[model samples]
Target: MAIELKPTEALKLWHDVNLDLVRDGETDLTTRQMTILLTIYLDPPPHTVRGLAKKLAVTKPVITRALDTMGKAGLVTRRRDEADRRNVIIQRTVQGSLYLDRLSDLIIARAHALRP
Candidate 1:
């Protein structure tokens, strides 16, 4: 089902979710971290630091730092690219999937509540 929401409603929903995340004592991810997380989960595989940096219009160090932080949180994993040993491939973890799933559910619920 498709649910359309005004920009104000969408922002409000995001704000609500962010508040709940903070209240739950969850690590509040930075905007950059969340962008990387969502990109890794939603986009096609074979994600690399270079690719992410290019896609996000940031520097390699930026992506590396975000990945390092997310890796420590078990939200993402990095492995040697067998095809090219020089490359590090970013992979999604079950924990990250569950986190995104919960976030998605929260957003959907908020959207539903906003429906007239």
Candidate 2:
């Protein structure tokens, strides 16, 4: 069933999840890194550095730096596009999917503990 949350409840849940993540010692992602990660996972495919920069209203270098960090974390990968050797395509990984799934579960558990 879907649970409707007021703004305060939503904010509290967000805070609780962040705290839990910190306690778990998961790699702390910056706001920009999180944005880029979510954009790659949640958005449609054929994701390119240029496309992501345009989508996030940031520069190519900004995306590249974030990707470098996330790549080391095994959250995302980049490869030259076969169709266009000059273009780099961003790809998702099993580790990245599992990481997001765990975070979702953490948020859900925190939300369930909230009083109506």
Candidate 3:
């Protein structure tokens, strides 16, 4: 017997689930920022702003802004691409890696708690 839920109900459920983490300060990242950060962190070092924009399906400006914010937050470092001096490459800092590790741990713990 499958159950159907209204769109609002589903959204509420998702909001509640997400809000719990925010309320507890488990994650400070906005959805878009987190997506961009994880996308770059998951891959090899030296991710370009353009490449990150493409990967995240967002505009280059969006990626640029996110990178700037992340940079200010000490979560990432941007360097001029050696091969292409005109382009910039983004890399995760030690702090960034630690943040990612913490996020993964929190998510895994939450998932485990939900299991029987």
Candidate 4:
């Protein structure tokens, strides 16, 4: 027999995953920062604040604020593009990658363990 989750329950499960991520270590990622990180990882190349805002359907100022937080957290680095000085590109640092990797592993393992 299998359990059928209600739509509300399913939504809660989605929220739970993100909440668990927030509880990791002594720090938590703001939703915007997490979104930025995910977007960069999914895209073929890193993006500038303007590009990220467009991709996220947000205003450039919002993306800039999120980037500022992420930068302070050491999750990303911003640099001027060599080919275009006006472009500020964002890249995940090794620490950020490792944090994401561990979070993924823990979530996967927990899900597998939950399967009866």
Candidate 5:
């Protein structure tokens, strides 16, 4: 499971996955957007605008903007916390999960296809 790659190999793998993403005509996520999505999915529950901003070391507006784009894409949804009306909690959706699943498959396939 732990595979090491040389710098060139790593770049090749990255390039291949990116090419596939472009070819598939899927949502083109910015680096920041992808980082936010990955953090939300890979991290624990109760994700909030404040929390993500702090964790990612970005401003709340920055998080909000990325969420806005991802929200429209159905990659994420937000709801005001009933307990604390000020907090916006981020929630995952079926579409978001499927998108990541496909992305994961693409990365794995591209990694396997890398020249040794």
Candidate 6:
């Protein structure tokens, strides 16, 4: 079944999900980091810093900085591609998958509880 919510309800769901993340005592990614994380997981692989920067319309340095933070959190790993050493490939982690799973649950729960 399709889900539907008013604009206020949608924002409320987002707020609640984000608030839960903040209180979860885990790695709370910044908005940029979250966007990058989602894009990486939602899209197909062979993710490169150059590709992400271009996709997000940002600079290579900006993507690098975000990756650095996420990398420290063990959410992602990067390595120089063997085929093309110039490209830094971004790989997913178990922790990152679990994090998004928890986030998905929170969003679903909040959406279900939205006021009619």
User: If scored against the real structure, what TM-score would every candidate get?
Assistant: 0.90, 0.89, 0.78, 0.79, 0.92, 0.90
lDDT for 108 (candidate 1) = 73
Clashes of each: 0, 0, 0, 0, 0, 0
**Candidate maximizing TM-score:** 5
- Kindly give the stretch of ten consecutive residues in candidate 4 with the minimal lDDT sum: 107-116
lDDT of 3 by residue, 5-82 (tens): 668666665665576668867467778898888987888766888888888788999988888888888998989978
Stretches of candidate 4 exceeding 4 Å from the true structure = 1-9
Q: Which stretches of candidate 2 lie over 4 Å from their true place?
A: 1-4
Candidate 2, residues 1-116: lDDT per residue as tens digits?
A: 98798999989988998898789886689989988998888999989999999999999999999999999999999999999899999999999999889978987799888884
C-alpha lDDT of all candidate models, in order: 0.91, 0.91, 0.78, 0.77, 0.91, 0.88
- TM-score between model 6 and native: 0.90
Worst 10 residues of 2 by lDDT: 107-116
- Model 5 lDDT, residue 25, Cα: 82
Ordered by TM-score, highest first, the candidates read: 5, 6, 1, 2, 4, 3
What is candidate 4's lDDT per residue for 1-116, written digit by digit as tens?
A: 99676686666656666667667555577777788887877677758988898888889999888878878888888988999998998887887887788767766665544434
For candidate 2, what is the TM-score?
A: 0.89
lDDT, model 1: 0.91
lDDT accuracy of residue 28 in candidate 4: 74
Cα lDDT of model 5 by residue, 49-68, tens digit: 98999998999999999999
Clashing pairs in 4: none
Candidate 1: 10-residue stretch with minimal lDDT: 107-116
